[model samples]
Target chain A: MYVAAKGGEKAIRNAHALLAKRRRGNKNLPSISLAQIAQQLTLAVDRVMAEGSLYDVELAALAVKQARGDLIEAIFLIRAFRTTLPRFGYAQALDTSEMLVRRRVSATYKDLPGGQLLGPTFDYTHRLLDTSLGVADEAGEVDDEARQADPADAAPVAMPRVTDLLGQEGLIEAAPADEGAEPFDITRAPVSFPVDRSTRLQTLARGDEGYLLALGYSTQRGYARSHPFVGEIRFGDVEVIFEAPELGFELSLGTVQVTECQSVNQFKGSATTPPQFTRGYGLVFGQCERKALSMALVERALRWKELGEEPGAPAQDEEFVLSHCDNVQATGFVEHLKLPHYVDFQAELDLVRRMRAEQAAERPADGIKEAAE
Target chain B: MALMARAEAGELEAVLAGFAPLPAASDLKPPEVGLVMLRGRTGGDGAPFNLGEATVSRAAVRLEGGASGFAYRLGRDVKAARAAAILDALWQDEARRAEVDAALAPVRARLAAEAAQVRAETAATKVDFFTLVRGED
Candidate 1:
């Protein structure tokens, strides 16, 4: 009797069991808790949240654990989970100005109204490994000097933005505000041609960090090269507001931590437009400042339309950049080719074979004679 | 007998009162409608093929003041077809529009609430990332 694939199900079950056992490793080793992962590996949680387009640290931590420390897998899990969600009311346009400034810095200015608060950045930290940290148990208390250095005690002040300073002196043209225009929903609606600024920014916010990094790097190396300066980069929590149907206006619902970047680019004078500095903006969820800044630079490069520049290069073309930007869609389309396609492939093979036979028949009799000789 | 009972109870009159009669219905015979082909797949497993067409009946009723309603269903059941035609007529009727809207109100409200709940659950898990050096052994 032919026993056809009797052990397939059993083999699959056994493999799954083995995988679970391997993932756990030696039981003696302390299992990593979700809280510990969230608190200790916060950057990974931040990346998962940023790319996954989810904000919950606990969920991100759980995803990291479930994915066996694979950040991409964690991101994929979050994205899949996000699709099941339905959109309620749109949040009121975020006011970045009112953000409780955590880390705010302007590369364009040496001194600003609100002095540069370094916050908790590792910009100047030495890359040396601290072996002593493994033995160190007791956490140190805040000294009197450190307490006095805290910027939180400072008065609530509305600092003039560095970009505004340039606009004040006519170094850069004022950004046109579209208060009436409704921003397109990138999640629900399919992204079509001639995308608006809001839709473009939304796509960039959830874009793959590595992909954007490579593209941004390419731009720096003279691929549609545009001289850019980090105008301002800020990371902090901003309140999300939404309009209730009963209430005519808007009200604050909750807050989300975001990284905002504004990149200033050098603009040459066009025939109709005068020479003035143009701006690129990137705002992403969580504390991914580097990714946000890279996104901002790429965004400015993509703004060939408003800049009155011809789309001769890849970066200058909006359709090219936006179409190929999403990693999820790209990965899905690429991997889908691996699915069973023997029938379609067989049809193509038959067509090619028939064509070759027809071509051979159509060839000269002399060619056949020469081959025979 | 049922038809006679309905006519005696003024049910047909009440249905007609809801909408202005269609210009085409002036003729004694009921209005003619066409079937829409229903496309479906065949084969238990492996590559599925389109399994031939099925006949469907469709009708449209236009009320006097420009409002219109449509009805469509598989197969030709005369009574069901007539009932559907009457429903279309009632839907187009300006007098019964408020009733139709009231009937749909609860369903629409439920759908909206479900959508809002889905959004809340999804938004609750949004995350952002920061760079960090991984611990080395």
Candidate 2:
């Protein structure tokens, strides 16, 4: 008895039209430029880029603009764009030690070798939104300082790892990379069960930051706790290097800003290896400190088996965490329910109506409507 | 090969246009262009994070003489993408390399000139920092 509704295409088209109209919002007002989004809404752009698994500011800004400030939608747009691109070759492994340090901090030691630089952080800033920021000129001294690079602002300093001190006494795990091993390309292959550490890390890298943060928070609430110590947290620019086949040598491409965290966790010994502390690492594009730190925590928590610890919680379960980490996939699955389910619902509707009519007939016909029992 | 890094959409198309009597290439895969999310790591040994997305166009073509060419370039320039693919196939055919190179010479020259222009502009603002030795030292 359910009538099939039509005009889905028309509805979608109209909705898109409405969205565009609202996106412009009163044409008299000046439009928001992509450059403005890239510069002003930097955190949003960074998040979109991180989640989208792309790293161009201008394009991210354009995505943000096209998506009308919807971060997830912007990420989707980037993903759609990324789907068609041809693969260039991969680059050599990046070295955090060579990073031109902008912001560096360590929670373990009171003092570090190169010293702690707070840099541009919201840590101490009052959360109160100042009215003055709403105005361009009122924000005080809109200068060229932020636009230009200054060597005098920050020296390229590489601080010694805080774990090195503890490691001297043989108290930390030595996490060595397998040289000359090709990392699993998650993009190229579907997610397999019991994924390798490289794939796990790669998936986690682009995983939703909020979800990871929540998972990390759950760990702090006594869910597979890895009593973490910040060995060093650094934010800075690092040059990209790749082997140029034509040149027959590795050449520097350019530099990109990144945030890295090396979290030293409690020491655990294997049967063969003596008691040594292990480190969870987090590295992300641009200046997303929270994501980086959360990644390290979640990464450390995921290392339960390698360190011989019991996999006790959700975060510890690699399959559960990795599978649910992608927001794009989760969002799509959840949002798909809003689409037409008329035929399926009509079957349920018919069944319910028939049951009701049968019950009515039985009750009216006789008091012989006794329970089956 | 040299143009891969620096060539944008317009320049690539202009260069591709130089091959006026464009050689017919059998479509192995028709050109498909889309944005790709760019990712990077810290210093390079770190967790990968999205830097941003870029438009990338790719095409693969096979020449009549059995040479195959595949091309990949940044941004959404399908014409340029197809041309590059054709040239790539032509390049593989030893007889066509010289002709292709000749056709692309102006494009390279233009790129070099533009690069030089940028260098000139940068040099205009070039500041050389100097060390002043202190008497105490």
Candidate 1 Cα outliers beyond 4 Å, as residue runs: A1-19, A132-153, A246-249, A271-273, A337-373, B1-137
Please provide TM-scores, in order, for all candidate models, with all chains considered together. 0.64, 0.71
Q: Evaluate candidate 1 and give its CAPRI docking class based on DockQ.
A: incorrect
lDDT of 2 by residue, A1-373 (tens): 3355687788789999999999989999999998899888988898887788776677889999998898988988887777756655566666666766667777776556766666567866889988877776476454433433344323334466565666677776545544555667688778778876667767878889999999988888889988887887878666555553333555444455678887888877767988777888777777888998888889888989878897779899999999999889988888877777788898999999999889777686453444432
Please report how far candidate 2 places residue B29 from its true position, in Å: 16
lDDT tens digits, residue span A1-373, model 1: 1122334678789988997787788999999999999888888898887777766677788889988898887888877865554333444455667766667788777566666666557777797766766677333333434333323335455756567788787777565554554456566578788876666766777788887887777778888677888888877766544443433554433355677777888878678767888777777767788788888878888887777766676766778777877777777787777655666777889999999888788886866887999
Question: Candidate 2: deviation at residue A45, Å?
Answer: 0.4
lDDT of 1: 0.61
Error of 1 at A354 (Å): 6.8
Leading candidate by lDDT? 2
